[model samples]
Target: MDIIRIDDPRDPRVAAYLDIRERDLVGRHGRFVAEGKVVLDVLFSAGRFAVESVLVLENRLAGLESTLRKAAPALPVYVASGEIIDRIAGFHMHRGILAIGNRGAGQPAESLLATLPAGALVVVLVGIANHDNMGSIFRNAAAFGADAVLMDATCCDPLYRKAIRVSVGAALKVPFASFGDAGHITALLDRLGFGQFALSPRGETDIRDAQRTDRLALYLGTEGEGLPEALLSRLRTVRIAMAQGFDSLNVAAASAIALHHFSRGG
Candidate 1:
């Protein structure tokens, strides 16, 4: 492994690791920060995203030696004291491991749709701006064996650090693409012969009763506003059966139920 020793927090070589809390908010162009050993394992194993480099606390390096040797031989592994790492990141990073990775050029939505199998199962999102919800949906998508996740332009970045961590690295495991608005997403899926269903509390069909289709797409919207009435009206709709008083579920929980139901060919 190409291990580089870094004592000074301000070293220019570690630019990507500096002030991460603020940088995460401002975005990192096409790059993302991966935290913790589990997340790093996924980032390295996926081989979909390219590793720029990794930062590790000196004490943590010994435990990760084998993983590093096999997973990232050519990559630079920078070691620092815990204090220095904390200073560099402007926060106490308890996990003691962070990796900088670059996202590959995104596949166009049309191209991704074109390559689906005959019995493809996909999750589509519109206006889902919450990072936690975005991550959970990807986790659910992966768990349920969805072919791909297609998100509208308004959705938050799935590659965002918190989202990636919350997903337990499903963001790396699953295939995804981002595209235009609800109309464009629906039109594309329609042209590709996908039966699309928008999930809503007031949906016409109970999720259990929704018929399975060979090629299916489930559209989930943001919390509070949910899917726009116009868009929901244009597609078949599904609702999870709920208790008497509560009319709705949290978006993430709803996604798990919806994805699970669809996976069972309901």
Candidate 2:
């Protein structure tokens, strides 16, 4: 294994790793750092990303070396003292393993829409800012057999650290894209003949009995505000039949239930 010892926090070679602390840095480089052995291992096993580098705390090197040798022998791994890593990253990185990789390019809405078969079920998230919830939604989508995830401009990045971790790496494999405007999404879905169903608490029809048409796009919103009134009016409103005591479920949980129902031919 080729191991480089990095002591200086300002070393140019380690600049990419340091950038993990700054949001602007991630934006400029078009990549984010994934920390912890499990998260890094999950990303590496996917074999879809080119790892720029790996940073391991000196004390943890022995334990992680064998794993890296088998999983990414050709990649460069850097050993840094814990204090140095903390100084560089602006936080205590207890995970001990950090990796830098390129972000995948998102496909156009039209192309994504074209790839799905007729009668397929899709998920669309609008203004969902919580990375944890975003990740959970992605995980559920994959588990329940949803074909794709679409995000509006206001949605959080699913590739963010908290999201990626919360998703248990499902975000890396799921097909997703973001739209600049709701109209762009509506137009594309309209062209593709997808019956848009807005999942709202006040929906007039229960999702179980709602007409199962060819190609359905389920629209979910932020937890606090629910679906936007304007977008709700543009689509067929459908609700999950809930027990009388509860008026709603958390967005992520609701997503899981709705996705499962749709997958079961509800």
Candidate 3:
């Protein structure tokens, strides 16, 4: 791998690495910043996102050689002092790793779902705007082997830097597509022949009692508001059945339990 040494933090080649914390909110015109070595590796495996460039602290370059050669061989790997990188990113990013990933024109929800196999297990997320919750759900989804994630329009960008970091790269590996709204997502799942189950504290059945089918899609909503009453009434509902006094689980925690249960048999 060719290493281009950078002394100035303001170099145009490393433009994408500038004031990342602030620019992250301004939008990247389809580009997303990925941090840490693990995330860079996952970005290579994502297939949908292209590795545009890499910026690594000088000391860590030796350890990342193989990964750079294997995954980002064609991309420029710019090396800089830890201090310079920190200045450029506008924070003390101790991980000493960063990469620019091009989030291409992702497939629409319907198209992405159509690509799944016949017995696919999927997660449907509605109004999960919290990046941390979104990330954790992706991690759980990947851990339990869900085929893909379907998100409603209100969901936050799973590619958001913090979310990707929190997922520890699962967000890159798992297939996901955002769509219209709760109603639209459920409609697509139905047309695709998935057995849909919306999780709610007042669910009609306990999670253990819910039957698993060949194609199952578990729906999880934001914590407080939970699933909308209109949407919940349209689908079958199942609850995790916690202690009597504790009626709810954070969306992420609930997802792990739900995914584990559904993934075990179906």
Candidate 4:
């Protein structure tokens, strides 16, 4: 495979890769950085996003020769020693694989929701700002056959490097879009004829006992505060039965159990 050797970290060709942690904070405009071999595999194979460029530690290139082959022949793949790569990234990259992906104009939530087939299962997230929780939720959504993930504006970007890495590349595979406020999302789901289920300890029915409709939207909110009382009371609320007094599960774990139960389609 043809490779470009980057001995200098500051070279203009590799500038997009510089100070990744800082860039992630300020946002990448329309671009996202994908790291690790697994994420790179998804970035190349998924076709959901356009790959801008690839930067790899020199020794890691041989192992990725086949994967890199999937890229357009003219695509630039920069190889650099570990030291140079570390200097550019502003942190140690143990996985030593990085690539920039551009998603362009993201699909509208309404457009994505309108395309689901009968028996669609989509996860709706609200006020979930933690990257790990966001990633875990997507991972579960992918694992359990969720058709799409719709998030409110309060949720963190799923394309963030840490979230994508935590999701084991599911972030790139599962289609997602951030919509407006909780009220707007709820109204749209209602308009789409989706049976909305808000998960909360105060829910009237146990999740195991909840019936899945042809179109179901499971709503998950941030930990501690959980879903809003107004929403919980209005929607068909369901709860994961827990032991006495202790009614807590990480939002991600809770989503898995709930998603798994409904995915079975009893």
Each candidate: how many clashes?
0, 1, 0, 0
Q: Which 10 consecutive residues of model 1 have the lowest summed lDDT?
A: 65-74
User: What tens-digit string does per-residue lDDT give for candidate 4 at 21-76?
Assistant: 99999998888999988888877887788888899998898899888887778778
Better of 1 and 3 by TM-score: 3
Candidate 2 lDDT, 1-266, residue by residue in tens: 57899999998877887646576334635776677776676677766566778888999988886568645667878889989998777789887788777885768767887889777888999999998899899889878777889998899888887787788777766778888888679878977888888899889899888876678888999878988898988889988787899676899998987787777443
Name the lDDT value of residue 259 in candidate 4. 95
User: What are the lDDT scores of the predictions, listed in order?
Assistant: 0.88, 0.81, 0.88, 0.89
TM-score of each: 0.94, 0.83, 0.96, 0.95
lDDT of 1 by residue, 1-266 (tens): 78999989989989998999899899888899988887788777777788999999999998887667656568999999999999999999888999899887999888988888999999989888999999898888888889999988889999998999999888987889988767887887898899999999988999999987889999999879999998998999998888899776889999999889888532
Model 4 poorest ten-residue lDDT run: 257-266
Model 3 lDDT tens row, 1-266:
55799999999999999999999798888998888888787777666678888999999998887667657556888999989999999999898899888888987988998899999999999899999999999999988989999888889999999999999889988999888867777887898899999999889999999988889999898898999999999999998888877776789999989998888644
Residue pairs in collision within model 4: none
Relative to the unseen true structure, what is the C-alpha lDDT of residue 40 in candidate 1, on a scale of 0 to 100?
Answer: 83
Candidate 2 pairs with clashing backbones: 119-215
Best-performing candidate as measured by TM-score: 3
Candidate 2, residue 115: lDDT: 86
